[model samples]
Structures are given as C-alpha cells and as structure tokens.
Target: MAAVPPALGSWGAGQEYDKQPAFQRLLTAADWRPAVKVAVAPTLVLLAAALIAAIPSDYQYEYRFQSAGFGERFGSAVSMALNALGAPFRLGYQSPLGHDRTDRLEIALRVLPMTVTVLWCLALWLGLRAGLRRRKAVVGQLTRGQAAAEALRTALVLAAVSGLLGLLGGTEWNPSGRAAKPDYFGDFGSGAQKSGQPLITAGSGWLEAVAWTAVLAGLLAFLVHGTDALRWAAWRSRAVRGWAVSALAAGQALAVTVGLSSVTAFVLVAATSESGAQTGISLAFLPNLGLNLLGFGSGATFRAHSGLSGSDGSRGDSSWGDRSSETDFSFFDLHDLTGDWRWAGLLALVSAALLGRVAFRRGLDAADRLRLAAVHAGALTLLMTVSGVLMTRTTSSSGWIGSARMEISQEESGGLAFVSVLVANAVWALAGALLVPPLLAAFRGRGAGAPQGAVPYAESPF
Candidate 1:
C-alpha cells in the first residue's frame, strides 16, 4: 500500500486492538465473566434448594391431575423458586361448562423455605468471597465504591437470569391437552361435557420482575455495606456492642431451642413414615415452622378463613358465605393435638432467661442491660414480622359448572397476629434482662470464692 496513514498503517500491519471502548467492553464475554462467575453458582444452588423443597409437595396437586410427570414437577419447582424470590404469579382458569363464565385466582406465596434461604445465603457469600479474591488478584485492593459497583453488576446478572428463568417456568399447565383447544368442549352434549377440566394459565408480571431485581440488588448491597456499618457502630459505642451481642446471643438461644424442636419432630416423622416426603417437607419448612412456633410461644394467634361463593345465572341467584376461626397453636401442638399450649410459653421464658444470663456475662451494667433487653425485644419483633410476611400464603380455586360459578379461598394468618406477639416477647425479654442478671450476680457473690476471671458487677466499667 502506498504511504498509508498512521491509523491505516497500523491496520495494514495486522495489529490487533487489545483495548476495547467502554460500550464495546460491555459486549465482550471476558468483561462479563467475573459477574457471571459470582452469580451462576449461587443461582443454581438456590434453584436446587427450591427443587428439593418442591418435590415433596407434588402430592398436594394430585387432586388436580391423576399424576405429575417430571416436566410438570420441574416447572412447579421453578415456579416455587420464583415465588420464594418474591415474584408474584397471576393464575387464570376457564371451565368447560361455559367460556364466558371464567374464574381467576391469584396466589401470593411469600414464604421462603428455610433450607433454600439458608443455602442461598451461604452460596451467595461463597460466590462473593471468591469473586472478590479474584478481583483483588487481578486489580489489587478495591475501594468501597469499586466493590459496590462489582456487587451491583453481579446482582444485575443474577436478577436477569432469575427473571428469564421465571418466564420459562411460568408456562401454563394444561392437563390432557384438551383444555388448550377452544372448541373441545363443544363436541360433547350438554350433560356429557367434562365439568372439572379447567384451562389453567399462570404468568409472572413485569412488575414482579422489577421488584425481584430491586430486592436482589438491595440484598447484595446489604451484604457488601451493612455488615461493615454494623461493625463500625459496635466498635464506637458500648451500648451498641452490648445490644448487638445480647441480641445475637438471644437470637442464637431461641434458634437452638426451636431448631432442636424441629429436628426432633422431623426425626419422629421420618422414623414413622415410609415414603419420607413428609420428612422432606419438614426439612424444607423447618425455619417457617420454628418462626410460627416462636410466634405462638410469644402469644400470637393464627386466624384461618375459608369461604365459598357462587352465582347461578340461569336461576338468577347468588350465594356467598365464609367462616373464620382463630387459635394460638404451634407446630409443637401436633405432638399432642391438645388445647394446652403452655409448653411453648414456658420454653420461650426459659430461652429468655438463658439469653439474659449470657448478656449479663458480657459485662453490661443496669442501663446497658435494659438497653440490651429493649433492643433484643425490638429485633425479635421485627424478625417475627418479616417471617410473617415471608410465610404468608394464599390460595383460591374457582370453576364454572353450567350456569353456576363458584370460588373457594383459604387464607392463613400472617401479619395480623403481630401485636400480641410483640407484647409477649417484650415482657419475656424484660423479665429475662432485669431479673436473671441480678439473681446471677447475687448467686455469684454468695459463692465461697469468686469464679476465676469473673468480673464482679461492682468492679465492672459499663
């Protein structure tokens, strides 16, 4: 080539462009690898946990169809995973009796299976740690802003993949393939038509996808920033340290007790059952069951409502009725199935006392102890509220037969019982903080010799 320009000379020499522009870098797979590496394993683990949890519940839908095949079960598992991640689905159905007489049921299942939730947290932590290590190896130390940007990028990747999975999993399930055809029911005579066959359709909305993205982003940000913030606060203030330690100890105590109870129950169920499905369900929902029991122990009551409503267009008649009942019960009640629920309360009280003693040993004075109790109470109450939100589930079924349309719905208690539980937990925490510490101090003082390395209340610096 004759006298090529500088740019053309480089091109003519067959030199590769080693550096890409920012926009072009976005399209490159190597640039995106770190984020994908951080997101993929955690996402897969979450899906697996969801699948394990879902497999046990396959029996519940047996009434809808004769048997569930692998594809149907897998779809259900993906749907459950999406729901656990806060995606909402709208369910629509049309009965064979009449096309115009359609019924729509939207179910909101906010419950996060404890097993899945725990596994997701663990996986995310591991993935983030590994990603951070790799980033440090490549680029040296990252500033807070850089770390946050990386987290955000990873979160976006995770959310996008999850949303895509939700779309793929939200496919409509039509049993027998007859429900998909609009005129299949038309061939049969009026009395010969199938009544129970419902053309069911389910879909997750755009809003749900957006909401899931925001939630995932927030969770990642918290993991990146909130833990450091909390540590700084604790280091700066004795009150914060006492409260943090006490709340953590109390939480651990309660968790251990409830976890043991759940494990015991699971063991019993597994020992007695042959198929092991129930045991799997128990393992999946261990956290939910524990929280429910904790709420019950704190005097929370669960209210259950079931209703049926119907209208007959030909007869020009409509009827609607619902019945509501409330009770203070826990998973432990299943052991005896009795009205006496006093054991739950007693267990709670004992846990409180143990946590209180643990808090006292952390060298908190009267004021700090009081603060510890208040903070612990508030923390526990907030946890209960969040668990309620997560554990809430609603399901409704409706169908049309001839000129009659009917709907049946059942809802479980979620946030409604918080008030009573709050009061109960506060009382128990206060009693534990105030009473047990003094008693422990007095008992220690009366000892023949002070316990080695024990800090006496009088000598303590609060």
Candidate 2:
C-alpha cells in the first residue's frame, strides 16, 4: 500500500515518443496549396526584390537618347533584377557604352533569392516543428523511404513552379530576335540599350531555375527533418548530435561565407573610392564588385577585356567586335588583372569555420567535433562550388570572324575557371574545417566546452 500502484502511462516519456509513428506525427496540408506556395517563394522573392528595386526615384536617366520609356525602363529594371539573380552564376554582361551600373540596389538584389531560399527552409522547419508539437496531423506509419519521398515531392513542386515562372518571364524577351542577343556572359545593359526589350530575355534560365529550385528544396527538407526527430533525441547517441552539429555548422559557414564576401567587396569599394582610384566605380559597380568579391573569396581571379579587339587593346568595345581565340589571348591579356584579392578568400575560408568550431566543441567530442566540422565544411564548399560554376563564365560573340573566331569570354581557359573556383575554395574550406575545430577543441578542452564524455587526444585513438 505504501509503494502504491505504478503511475499512469509509462516509466519514461522516451518510450512513449518512440512508440509514435513518423507519418502520423508529420505535417499535412489541407491541400496542395502550401506546397505550391513554398515552390513559388523563390520566383516571387526575385520578382518582389526586382519590383522594390524599381522605385523610380532610385534611378536617374543616364542617357538622353534613351528616354525613360515604359518598356525601356521596365526592361532595364528587369535586366538589373535578373542580373542580380544571375550574379552568382558568373553572368556579368556589361552595357555597350558602359551605361550598365552595379549599384547598391543590384548588390542587395543579388542575395535576395538566396535569402528567400533560407526563409523557405525555415518555414518548412517551423511547420514540421509545429506539427510535432501540436499533434495536429494523423496518418499511417511511414518508413524512412516514404518520408524521403515526401520531401522529394516538395522539391519537384518547387522545381515545377520555378520552371514555369522562368518560361513565363521570358515570353517577351526572346533573345532569338536579336537586336543583339541579350548577352548572358556580359553586360545586360547593352541589350537593354534598344527600346521594347525585356530583362532576362536569354533562353538559358529555365533549366537552371528548375534545377536550383529542386536542389534548394531538397536540402531544406533534409536539414529540417534530419535533426529534429524525436527518435534521435531518444537514442541519445553522440553520433546523432555529431550529425546535428555538422549540419548547423555547415549552415552557419555558408551564411558567413556569403556575407563576408559581400561585405568585403563593399568595404574595399569604399576604400577605393576614398583613395581616388575611382576605378570608374558606378552604381552598377556594386553588383559587379559583390560578384567579384564572391569569386575572390572562393579563390578565383577576375580579368575582363577592356577591348576585345585583335589589336593592342587600342581598339574599343563592341559586342560583335569581341574576340578571344588563342591568337587573341595575348591582346586581351593586356588588360588581364592581378590583385591581392585572394587574401579575402583566405579570410572567407577561415571565417566560415571559425564559429563552427565553437559550436562543435560545445556538444561534440574532439573527434566528433572535427568530423562534424569537416562534414559541415564539405556541405558549405559544395554550395560555394555551385556558386562558382555560375559566376565563372561571361561569354559574348561566338560567330566566325574571318579565319579567326570569336569566343568572347574572360576565362581564357574556356570554362575551367568555374571548376578552378570550385576546387580551390573547397580545398581551402575543407582544410580549415578539418583542422580548425580539432585544434580549438584541444586548446580549450579538459575542463570547459568539452562534450559530455570526451577524453584528451593523447588518451584516445583520435
């Protein structure tokens, strides 16, 4: 009688939670609309950013001949908008007369799509968290494969929306018409020089848009679902925390890499302006600068033809006049650049993982923290590589010009620059990620910030 009967439910809450099914606990939409909404977020964010950037007061009419007609202005605004989205893709088409700008608006706009992607991820995470917390949805039990399939379904929806929006957006600006094909590789402004053109007219974005949408959605789903499982907490395995640690570290690294690159570029530009190099910096320069900063941060270099003529760069700029066969590299290399910009890249690599180490040490053993850092760094580098692939090509003029042909592009290595960007930065970041955490853990451990059961390096197999 003194001992009394066992209390109602269970000995431990963990068993009760483990008994529940994942599918029954998962979030369910009333219909397909929420999926559709998530899918549409990227394109809508781009459009919204573009629209906001188009506040008439933000721009001043630069060319008198180019009156602020509705189509021209709209096209220019759209060009700026699309270019912002494409900046990471190495799409750096310059206007013919140097009328194209790289302003703060363009710079700000470049990151909007990425920001939207993150927001979508957070939304999915919150939705999942709510579903579990409120026990709102009821369904049959789900296997891991089923859960994965559900995530993929969300990804496909996102891809479909992106593809549709990309196609619809370009209905007006068929590059096939050719006042001059809107150069995907160089200045978008030159294309907009004529009236009635549309921004983002090149027929190249649909595949990319769809592909990116799927990738981003899938990653978002994986990241949200993997870490917050009730079962994971129940297992209490250090390995689970390692996965979570790395995932969080990787996310933080990615954000830091992007942010530092952008900020570094802006600060340097301000320095240049103050120093009177002028660099002929224009408002359009901000986007270009930020783009270049991205490249620089990822251990890539930048060079552009001031004039793509076969002569001593004595001749001037023209889209058709642009030429860069092997015979032309010597001439174009005349304006080839060399800068100390890679220092910024080193900083980016280190900074990306610095916070990751602090985070890793808090919840993970030295080996696990190191492993988590490496994993996170790898994910971060994958993202950086994708960004590099996008920003490494800016080609113009591909028709034969006499015996010589035109393959106007800044990357003399054809397309290897993107590959170079991806490889170099990834190697740098991986090294930093792998090395930094263990070193810091070793230095700071033994009494503080060590994981629950970690031992000193000398005592362990490592």
What TM-score do all the candidates reach, one by one?
0.69, 0.54
lDDT of 1: 0.58
Q: What is the C-alpha lDDT profile of model 1 across 104-183, one tens digit per residue? A: 55554555555565566567767777766666688765655665666667667777777777777754666653222335
Write down the lDDT of every candidate, Cα atoms only. 0.58, 0.45
Q: How high a TM-score does candidate 2 get?
A: 0.54
Model 2: residues >4 Å from true position, as ranges? 1-31, 40-43, 56-146, 171-204, 225-241, 271-356, 388-445, 448-462
lDDT of 2 by residue, 200-309 (tens): 32222456656765776776655444333423442455566566555566666556655665566667767666543343233334433444455555555443322333
User: Which candidate leads the pack in lDDT?
Assistant: 1
* Structure candidate 1, residue pairs in collision: none
RMSD of each: 7.6, 13.3
On TM-score, the candidate that comes out on top is 1
Runs of candidate 1 with Cα error greater than 4 angstroms are 1-24, 27-35, 53-66, 88-93, 99-108, 132-151, 177-197, 202-213, 224-258, 264-275, 306-341, 386-416, 444-462
Which stretch of 10 consecutive residues in model 1 shows the poorest summed lDDT?
A: 447-456
**Candidate 1 TM-score to native:** 0.69
